[model samples]
Target chain A: MATFMDVHRGMTGITDEQLREAHAADLAIQDEEGVSFEHAWADPDSGVVYCLSEAPSPDAVQRVHERAGHPASEIHPVPLAV
Target chain B: MATFMDVHRGMTGITDEQLREAHAADLAIQDEEGVSFEHAWADPDSGVVYCLSEAPSPDAVQRVHERAGHPASEIHPVPLAV
Candidate 1:
């Protein structure tokens, strides 16, 4: 599976706890799309949330997020990790 | 400790292997500054890298990255989590 980093912008004022809940919610439904969410991070001040996941394609990742009610503004493949 | 997400810009063309090496190198030296790097993600096409870490302050995180020779363009605190 390829790794992906999806970004959600304009989320200013969103708290970390809210992100955690959203992430969990996404994970709960992700299996339907073959996406596995690994981690999530957010910058409350900038309103940018990032999610790391492994999936067949970016679309799968996006579909998961979309279903979770927080669709990403951009999704990019992460070809490296450590 | 608080979590942080640091962004590195203008890293276009950097491969996954190179990032892995850099992340490992950072981990090797991070303890000196009291920073614990948890994970790293890079978008090769966008020349952007995101690192998740736990540290006393953003400065400590910046110091570690600077020492690793990959200074961050921005750093933000993450105050909430699941």
Candidate 2:
């Protein structure tokens, strides 16, 4: 089993290019920490981003995010009924 | 092993009481159709609701929503990395 973190973004202050850069930095941080980001999506209007990831625990997710300099807004446990 | 659908809601046209009623009705519709609603959450500000359900097919999810008289705004397939 793994824990996932849903990271929200404040897109109003950041440009699209900046967001991509941040995502790249975060991806590297997560990859180094052995966290697999299953999927991530952004709402253009809301500027919120939801990330689905597989990590040993929620703390690991936070560690990677902290290293990336963008901590998550909320983390939710994803337990699949399947 | 199963397909999951994320159902979105619109809160502007409805009240809290109305939303609860709709949820109850949707829950019943989904339950009768063999879809297990594993979890659900709502955002008070946006009036958007997200429902996670384990269903055999995406069409099954739509069927329940249609029966409940509130088809989802968007349904995304959830695949757990765990």
* Strongest candidate by TM-score: 1
What docking grade applies to model 2?
A: incorrect
Which digits, one per residue and each the tens of the lDDT, describe model 1 over residues A1-82?
8999888889899975688789888989999999999877777888878778899999999888888898899998878676
Distance from true position, residue B36, model 1, in Å?
A: 1.3
Per-residue lDDT of A1-82 in model 2, one digit per residue for the tens? 4746464656434445656666677788777778877655554444556666788787787788778787888766543212
What TM-score quantifies how close candidate 1 is to the native fold?
A: 0.86
Chain B TM-score for each model? 0.95, 0.74
Write down the worst ten-residue block by lDDT for model 1 chain B: B73-82
> What DockQ, on C-alphas, does every prediction get?
0.55, 0.08
How do the predictions measure up, each by TM-score?
A: 0.86, 0.49
Clashing pairs in 2: none
Q: Which stretches of candidate 1 lie over 4 Å from their true place?
A: none
Give the lDDT of residue A25 in candidate 1: 88
Task: Count the clashes in each prediction.
Answer: 1, 0
